[model samples]
Target: MSASDHPAAIRLRQLSIRLGLGSAAFEAVQNVSLDIEPGQFVCLLGPSGCGKSTLLGALAGHLTPASGQALLDGERVAGPHPERGLVFQHHTLFPWKTVAQNVAFGLKMKGVDAATRQRQAEEFIDLVGLTGFARHYPGQLSGGMQQRVEIARVLINHPRVLLMDEPFGALDALTRLKMQELLLEIRERIRTTVLFVTHDIDEALLLADRVLIMSPRPGRIIEDLPVDLPRPRFAAAGSARFASLKQHCLALLRYDEPATSLPRLTPLGAPPAHQLQFAI
Candidate 1:
């Protein structure tokens, strides 16, 4: 089977999230409210120490809200679910397992029989253009190739909402562009709601249906700008429209900011005490 053809709507109302302990605890996100329609690609754009990941963590069920609602399809997001799949900057693949095994891990967790898991795993592996590398270990692949495996791993579960935390942040410039193209192509077939976090300006403009500009700590949505540029946006750079939106985004990110950068916060309340293992 392919990814869930059914995309889910996301709603947040007056959401406030506090992170850290008594001495250090502060509002990561305060009274934020927004709605993401089914299959819309939205980029959370902001600078360091902003609450982009914090808000995304809440929706993924990794971080709890201090108050207000985080709902998926009108149901509160209490914890992580496969339908709301999250992919991080680094590859979270198993070092010991081959690429196919890593991609199929989610299915294996759900107790699908081995044969069907491998079959579906192959389909998604090919979808991400890693067709013949199924037996290669993550270490055996380049950073971009490993990320492709990570994407295929997440896609194998057919998530309704694809939550990405700067999945290409670590790649080289050329590779990053290719991965961006790959993501747009895959989303065409999956049509899942995507809430991606990024600090890059053009990356947001290139990939999103709308870009949500956020402020520094106690993060709040300051602006919701639509990306009216046409799709297959690779050549959108020369357009007058693209230049205008890029300048606007630059200005918005500079709005109401302190001179010094804030320390970035993870989706977890504080920094993760330990590394997270795959729970899919």
Candidate 2:
């Protein structure tokens, strides 16, 4: 389907999520609303405890909102379904299953014939660069390889909205960068709508079409910034425009001030001394 004709991949309206019950209930997220268009890559960026994952859980139907609604394709998201696939930071692969078996598990559950499931499984295994390791168990693979298996498992089902909560957070720096590149490559091939959660400003900038920053507890979207940089962004990390946008995001998170209130940064090759210490 054309981008315009594709359905709304995700929509939230005044969504509020509370934890606990009765008087013990405390709001985790409040009055947050956003839309993710089909085939778009959107990132939820915030501090460690700012409800980024809470919002993701609500969308995944693992947690229900105390108020308002989480919708997929204009329909209320009452519970988990195959259309919304979730991948977490940790690999949840079954230890006994080989790489191919892990990827084919979903299809098997849906009663796909053995021959078709095997064919589909191999295709995604290769897609994730695990072709030769199809017979290896999850325990035998590296952390990065195991995560790739988890991704292939999810993508094999062809979910309309892929909810990833720090999917690469556990990988080493080099592996994480490779995984990010792999994700972009896969997206080009399948065009699945993605909602990725990260606290790293650089990662958000590099991957998202738009980045939404959330506030502290009772999390709300404090900043919604579009990433207009060109593709293959791996090389643009040090560009002037890239640094400027990074500084803007840092100022918002560090100073908790409006964008206008922040003074314009110097045009020197390096960011100011104060800007250097705002850790991601």
Candidate 3:
């Protein structure tokens, strides 16, 4: 379907996930529903252990839900598929492998020929701006560089949906800022659909087109706020409007009152470029 015909690249229907069984059972997510439009950058923001990662995994098809359903292109998500690409908080690079090799590894398993894999790997490496480091091993690279390789590895696959779980969480403040810019640049160039998870509201504001806030535990979506801030939002956190939105999210987080009902997604007006508010 066309982008307008199918607004959301991914959609969830009454999704509830319960881990373990009987006495050991715990519901990680309950009655959560969301729609992530194609080419949109969405962020899942919540406190630690609030199941943001679990919700991402369920959307990425890594974890199954106890009830409800997750859909991509209107089809049920059966299991892990190449259609979705994931980059975890911790870089999961093989230290023994060179940067280029690690990036090429996925294509290699897919039976892509050697020359083609190498060419594709090189292209993605360049895309992540890690061209010269191709031959270097992960051990030889700095933490930021290692994460770049992780991003390159996932991007090389050309997946339709990208799931990033705090990809820059391990970096220092300065490095985190740099990575954020790089991500926006790459996303602009590639137009990839992204679902990013982070606890930092400022990071979410900078990178996402929409921010979904989750309640404390038994994680359920509390707010689906549309961020109408213009692109190149690098220093967005410092902007007055951004600060306002950040405070709003924090208030929702700190409020102990239970949400009587889940926030519903609806078509709403765009927030003025310099003034931010949740699009109702």
* Cα lDDT listed for each candidate: 0.88, 0.86, 0.84
Candidate 2 structure quality by residue, lDDT tens digits, 1-280: 1112242478899999999888998999999988888888999998888899999999999998989999888899999977788999998999999999999999999999999999989999889888899899999999999999999999888888889999999999999999999988888787778999999999999999999988778788877788878998989999978988898777667655454554344444555655444523
Winner on TM-score (1 vs 2):
1
Regions more than 4 Å wrong, model 2 = 1-8, 257-280
Poorest lDDT segment (10 consecutive residues) of candidate 2: 1-10
- Alpha-carbon runs more than 4 Å astray in model 3: 1-8, 260-280
Poorly placed runs, candidate 1 (over 4 Å): 257-280
- Could you give the candidate ranking by TM-score, starting with the highest? 1, 2, 3
Q: What would the TM-score be for candidate 3 when compared with the true structure?
A: 0.89
Would you give me the overall lDDT of model 2?
0.86
lDDT of 1: 0.88
**Counted clashes in each candidate structure:** 0, 0, 0
For model 2 the TM-score comes to 0.90
Q: How do the predictions measure up, each by TM-score?
A: 0.90, 0.90, 0.89
